[model samples]
Target chain A: MKKINYNRELCDFCGTCVSVCPQDAIELSENNLEITDKCTVCMNCVYICPLRALEVKNEG
Target chain B: MKDRYDVIVVGGGPSGSMAAMFAARAGVSVLMLEKDREIGLPVRCAEGVGDKGLRSVVDINPNWIAQKITTVKLISPAGMEVVIGTDEVGYILNRKMFDPGLAELAAQAGSEIITKAYVNGLLLDNNKVTGVRVRTLGREFQVKASIVIGADGVESRVGRWAGIKTWEKLNDMETCAQVTAQNINVQQDAIHLYFSNTRAPKGYLWVFPKGNGLANVGIGISGEASRHKSPFAYLFEFLQTNFPQAAIITTVAGGVPCAREPEKIVANGLMLVGDAARQVNPVSGGGIVTGMIAGKIAGQVAGQAIIDGKTDEKRLAEYARLWQKAEGKKHKVFYKLKEFVYNMSDKDLDDTAKIALQIPQDKRTILQLFKTALVQKPALILEAIKVLT
Candidate 1:
């Protein structure tokens, strides 16, 4: 499975990813941005992050 | 602090503040929660509102006005430019100041606001919302309220938490990027909008001047079209061609819910306002005014419902009914118009630009273009007349 990873340094936390996420997995706030269990590694957030703060991590 | 109130508003944007302010004025105890530490920072909008749209809701404060606009410059991909002059006033607002100003009004109306007080989820009782679960730096607790107004904007979770279908499909979502830049050359008193496919597929690029060579330059591409190409790419291309010498100051990206306002914005004891309900103008992707309008109606209805001890979906439907009667129906006309306009090919747009030039200068208004576009649909033209005029 491929899981999504986020880098806090690069994130703007603008909630762009939350709107485009088809699975409704991303939760954003003033200080924290969490990708919950509902995320299916859809990569919508990864592709759409304007700051490139998110990526996909492979699992074995 | 007390854990109970008559109403709780989530998010502190134009809609939330309007909801909170009006509800509090109705003599109900209202609590407004803001996820941001500040009332207005990290602006996610182009911040332009029509003169009439602003005045119809509230009186204008000079401090919030960044610039007064007198003309609109519409440009085509082929370099065709049509300048339409307007007598009615328009403004490019300083939203960093404007949003908080509205929140101040809410506070003056006796709405208790807590910044950085994030409402993480809804507190439902037997399928009816009774309150909200909030987390602040000080502590976390559940606060009870008769109604919750979700004015949480495009990334709204409150509506979803309340079990209303709130997701905007990719086709209806306008993925966007914007920058406040300096040392750019453009008309100071006019807003510039560029239409193209390669530059902004199924969307448009805008330059709103804020005087002294500073402007908010932005672009929006349909989420479906932006699946492969990001809005950043399109925005960079536009800046490269138009303002290569410009120095970028701030960059922000987001989505505009360019979909139809949900048929159901009210669930049991819950009402969604603003972008949460997708009350944005489908054609322009602007909601600052429409959101406030819906917010006022939502707050009024919610206050009355709570005072009458009936806050269920049946009673809350009055908000939706009044909003739909006021602007939601017109939004439908604009949505249909959006489908027709956004689906046009690059060539179709350029041709339309050429055809637009054929009309006399003073007569070439946005309404004229809309009438021409919907010529095949006379019924739609009739509705547009009711909306535009």
Candidate 2:
């Protein structure tokens, strides 16, 4: 499965990723960005992140 | 920690703040939770509002005014320009100050305001919202409320958590990119709008001047059309062509819901306002005024429901009824108009502009321009009359 990784240092918690995610997978809480199991790895957030804080990874 | 309140308003944008303010003014204990440490930072909006649309709701604070605009210029694909001048004015806002200022007003009206409070989910009892579960500063806690008002923006989780279908079609979503640029030569008092399939693709590009050689340059492309090219790329190309010497100050990318309001804005013990409710104007993709209007109505109804001791869907349905009567009906018409406009070819748009320009400049109005565009649809003439008048 392809997974997502978020760089906390680069994220400003803009919530743009949360809005673009069709599956409701990404969340921005106080601690950090959390990707849930519902993620289809469609990479919507990866492209939408203004700061380039999100990256996609394949973890088989 | 205290965990209960009469009303809990989620998100601290214009809608949430207005909801909180009105609810608190109604003599109810209201709590407003904002996820960001500061309200309105990382501004996402182009921040233009018509004078009538804004002043009808709240007093215009001078501090929030970035620029006062009196003219609007529409540029067609073939470089045809049609300028409309009117006594009716518009203002571009400094959202960084405008948002927090509205929140401050809510606080002054007696709503308890808390920043850095991110709502993780709802606390439900028997499928009815009882409160919200929040995470703040690495701590998790639950706060109970009689009514949960979801004024959260387009990315609203509160509505979905409450089981309302808040989905939008790809064609109805506008992928947007904006930048505040310095040293751009723009008409100081005129806002420019550019329309073309190649330039914007089912959307439009805008240049709103903020005075002193600064302007907000932005583009909004329909999400379906954006598949071939990102909104950022479209905007970058436009900027390079028009304002090559402009220095970019900040860049922002986001999505705007350009669809009809969801059928259901209220559920058991819950109500949605603002972008969560999809109250934005489909044609303009502008929501500040509409959201605040929805917020006002939602707050009033929620406050009344609290006092009446009935927080179910039946009582909460008044919010939807009132909003539909107020703006939802018009928004529905605008949605249809948006579809009609988006379907137009570049040549069609150029022809429409040429036809509109045939009319004398002094006699020209936005209504006349729309009439030219929709001249083929006689039925829409009546609908446009109702909407424009």
State each model's CA lDDT, in order: 0.86, 0.85
What DockQ, between 0 and 1, does each candidate earn?
Answer: 0.56, 0.33
Q: Which pairs of residues collide in model 2?
A: none
DockQ value of candidate 1 = 0.56
| Error of model 1, residue B330, in angstroms | 1.1
C-alpha TM-scores of all predictions: 0.94, 0.92
Give the Cα error of residue B323 in candidate 2, in Å: 0.4
Give the per-residue lDDT digits (tens) of candidate 1, residues A1-60: 888989999878888678778777988988679999899887767766656678899877
State the weakest 10-residue window (summed lDDT) of model 2 chain A: A44-53
Candidate 1 chain A: worst-modelled 10 consecutive residues by lDDT:
A43-52
User: Which RMSD values do the candidates have, in order?
Assistant: 2.8, 3.0
**lDDT tens readout by residue for model 1, B222-335:** 877777788888899889988999899989888888997776999999999999899998878999999999999998898888889999999999999999898988898888
